[model samples]
Target chain A: MFDTLAAMLDWFGIVVFTVTGALVASRKQMDAVGFVLLGTVTGIGGGSVRDMLLGRLPVFWVAEPAYLLTCVCVAFAAFFLAHIPASRYRALLWLDAVGMALFAVAGAERALLSGTAPSVAVAMGVITATFGGMIRDVLGGETPVILRREIYATAALVGAALFVLLSLAGASREAGLTAGFL
Target chain B: MFDTLAAMLDWFGIVVFTVTGALVASRKQMDAVGFVLLGTVTGIGGGSVRDMLLGRLPVFWVAEPAYLLTCVCVAFAAFFLAHIPASRYRALLWLDAVGMALFAVAGAERALLSGTAPSVAVAMGVITATFGGMIRDVLGGETPVILRREIYATAALVGAALFVLLSLAGASREAGLTAGFL
Candidate 1:
């Protein structure tokens, strides 16, 4: 049940990030292919960066190509449904925040499992939470939201640190994850 | 002798790219640490991207700590020596171009050695040649040079493709490298 919940949360985070990427593509007035490209990259990019830093071979999406297919389908859905949206900007921001929190906790868990230093785990968590959006924004021809003097990254950092510390202190994984996500 | 020369060329390309990154930092009027960060990232960023795409475990710098040290030392030297001002803009452009060519061939060679298809090899070469500058420019708060209406990427693509084709046609590695670098 723990693994199942964790996996579901991870997929949810990815879907959220993919929606955000496709929304950015819509804002950029890109073609369908552009939406898929941006969305897929945004979905997998953060985890890939974290894995590369931690020396995890094949990254995750490479070993399991289902993630790429999921991103494509999600992005396509977003692209089509975006036309019917009335006020997407606010929802986009909210979804992005939720994705950030989920990824922060999940990334830290992976780092801890890898037996990295506590600090490295925290850093990886923040990186994993934020890097996908950075790539999306950069590739979408805009300045990244994190560089816009936003407090979002700071929140992620604090949350990630708290989670790692809690894990190190022998707290249950579920407790730590909830604390980090909250 | 071939191995020695190949290694020397690789290091030269790194140094040249590092100088361009430092020049970008200088243009941005960044401090010493910022300069170092930008320089080292520019020096190794392209190769790292290539390694990640090819699923090369540990990336190059992780497996060989010496590369990181080289980047750090070179960046520091660049930071200190940049004050000796002569018009550096032209030198920066030329150095970047040379570095791009060298990396293009080297990256293709690596991709082919990993048994990727010819097209993938060419693509990797271009990514390894250009991704560093893109990262440096993006992080330095500027649009990437590749995004500009420039013939640079076209040149990189042509060069990379030619190198891969030459290798596929049974030309010597040295010959392909030379053709690509030219």
Candidate 2:
């Protein structure tokens, strides 16, 4: 039951990241293919890095085509939807935040399962949470959030550590994610 | 003596990566600052991702100012030299191959020392080898080599596995790298 919920959350995170990436690509006047590329990278780049680091096989997206499919579908929708004035940047930012929070918790959990130390797991969590956006920004010719004087990496670190602490205390994964986000 | 040699090789790799990245930026009509960004990312991005995966702390460039300095200096040089008829795209491709080869061996060695399995070490090696170029291409709005019909990732994987195998058979690090490259 919890596994199902976690899977759903992961899917949600992927969709949100894709949407945010598509919106950014739109602002850059990129074509539809470029939007899809950015969206896919934003949705999977961090987790792919984390998995490769942890020595996990097949990578997260390769292991399950669902995430990749979701990203593609979301990007296609966003390419058209981004034409609407209602696609506010502020809303995309908020959604990206939510996605980041969820991905951080997921990354930390995966790191812990890979037998990494708590501190390392926390760091991986932050990497997994923020790296997609960082890649998107860099590719879009914008300064990465990590390179800027932003609260981005710090927020990811805090959220990841909080999730780890909650999970170590025997909280459910959903609870841990909620605690981290809150 | 070996340490000095290793340091030289590492710096050489850094310079090559930085030059290539800066050249790409120049072709894109990016300014000096854009060249700097591209150069830095190409030089350090691979190793940073490798360290993050190996659970290493602070990342190499973040720990060693010299690495970042080297990249910055190369970027500055490349920026000023951009007006030369360098046929930068071809040069960038070849330089990228060298960087990939060096980084692949280094990353595999690090992973092996950290007690990762041979297969995982090889994967890490590929990540270290290709990730920077992936970042460079993506940021430059080009398709990543790994995602293309290139033999790039395969080359890295073969080289990394050879390195790990040779090291396990008691070959020196230098010998392993040479064998891997060959």
Candidate 3:
């Protein structure tokens, strides 16, 4: 049950991330290919880097084309959505935060499952949460948001650490996930 | 003999890449931390990405701290050298080209040794040759050098293909390396 929930949330997070990527491209006056490339990279770039660092084979997106397709679909949708009024910028921030929270816990859990130390798991969680945004900003010709004076990476670090501590305290993984998400 | 030569070239390339990264940081007026971060990423970023895609564990710099140290040293040196004059820009470009050529063949050879198909190996070589500069450009808030109309990625592509073809035609690996370098 927890696994299913996590998978669902992961897909949801991908959608949110992809939309933001596309939105950035549209704001930059980029074409379709730019939107798709940025969307795909922002949605999957972090987890792919994490998996590679852990030596997981076939990288996540390579093993599953569905994820790549989702990124493309959402990017296309965002291309249309970008025509709407500018107030949606506020919605983007909130959506990004929610997605970031979800990914942080999931990344930590995956690290723990893969037998990483608690510290490493926490770092993985943070990386998974923020690396995509970092890549997105960089590709968009800006400094990474997390590296700047944002409350972003800090939030990810705290949540990931909380999750890892809970797990190390012998709490159920589900309980840790809930706490981290909250 | 080939192994030794490859190793030496790899280190030389790292120094060149690191210097370029540091020079970019200087041009951007970044701090020490930025210089180090950019330098390290540019120096090892390509091989690290390739190894991860191939499921090679721990990434190269993570497994061997020496590469990271070399990047740091070169970055520090470049930080000071950046103030000298504008004439060094010419030298930087030549060094970058040499480094790119060396890394292309080395990346291809590594992929071939890891048992990937020749096509995949060639792609890996292109990636290894181009990825570091791509990352550095992104971090420095510029379009990637490869994405622009430069004789850059094309050079890496030709070298990688030449090396792979030479190997397939029953030439010694050293012969392939030398031919690819030229």
Candidate 4:
């Protein structure tokens, strides 16, 4: 039951990241292929890096094609939906926040499972939560949020630490995720 | 003596990758900061991914500031040298080849040292050699070579296999690098 919830959250995080990345690429006036590339990278880049760091095999996306398919679908949606006159910037921000929160908690858990120290796990969580967006921004020729004075990576780190503390305190994963996200 | 040679090759690879990335960014009319980001990512991105996969700590460029410093210097050079009209495409292709060869040999050696199987080590070598450029291209709004019907990844894989084969035959590191590059 717990595993199923965690897996769902992971997939949700990937979808959120993909949407954010697709939006960014649309704002940059990239073509469809470029949008898909950015979206996929934003969805899986950080976790791929984290898995590699943990010496895990095959990479997460390669083992499961669902993540890549989600990114592609998001990219397609962005292509048609970006024509709407709505405030996409706000949507992008919210989706990015959700992705950051979910990815941070999940990444920290994975790091801990891989035998990393608490501090390192927290750091890896932040990296896993943010590095994909950083790559997206860099590739899109924009300054990454980390390079800005925005409350980006710091937020992820705090959320990860909170989740770890809660887990150590015998709280449920759901409780920990809620606390971290909140 | 071999350590000194390895260090030199490592620095050379860093410089080449950085300069190439900066040149590409400049052609795209990006700012100085953009050039630096692209250059650094192109230079250290592959090795960072490789280290993460092998479960190495601190990452290579993060632990050794020399790589970062070399990239900075190379980026500076590229900023000034961009005015010259010496076939950017050709330069990019050849520089990529050199970078790929060096990375393939280095990655295979590192994977072997980390106790990976020969086949996995070769795959790691190919990933290390190609993934940086793949990331660079994707971010630059270009098709990644891996997705293209090019001989690029094939070259890297062949090089990696050659390096592993030579090493298994008790050849020196120098000999392996030479054979792999050739």
Winning candidate number (TM-score) = 3
Report the lDDT tens digits of candidate 4 across residue range B1-182.
65676566666777777877876777666655556656777888788888876778657654455676677677777877776857887788888888887887778878887899999889988988887887677666566768872576788899889989998899997898788877
Candidate 1 pairs with clashing backbones: none
lDDT of 4 by residue, A25-120 (tens): 888888888888998899998888777655666788899888888889887787787758388778877788889888998888877676666655
lDDT against the true structure, per candidate, is 0.80, 0.78, 0.79, 0.77
| Predicted complexes: DockQ each | 0.12, 0.06, 0.19, 0.08
Determine which window of 10 residues in candidate 4 chain A has minimal summed lDDT: A143-152
Which candidate model has the greater DockQ, 1 or 4? 1
In order of lDDT, best first, we have 1, 3, 2, 4
TM-score of each: 0.60, 0.57, 0.63, 0.59
Ranking under DockQ, best-scoring first?
A: 3, 1, 4, 2
Best by lDDT: 1
> What would the per-residue lDDT of candidate 1 be over residues A51-133, giving only the tens digit for each residue?
98888865776555577678879998887888767777777788788888888888887888899999999999999999999
Q: Report the Cα lDDT for candidate 2.
A: 0.78
Per candidate, chain B TM-score? 0.93, 0.92, 0.94, 0.93
Docking class of 4: incorrect
Give per-residue CA lDDT, model 3, range B31-59, as digits (tens): 66567667767888788888877877867
**Any idea how many clashes model 2 has?**
1
Candidate 3 residue spans exceeding 4 A from truth: A1-47, A57-130, A138-182, B147-149
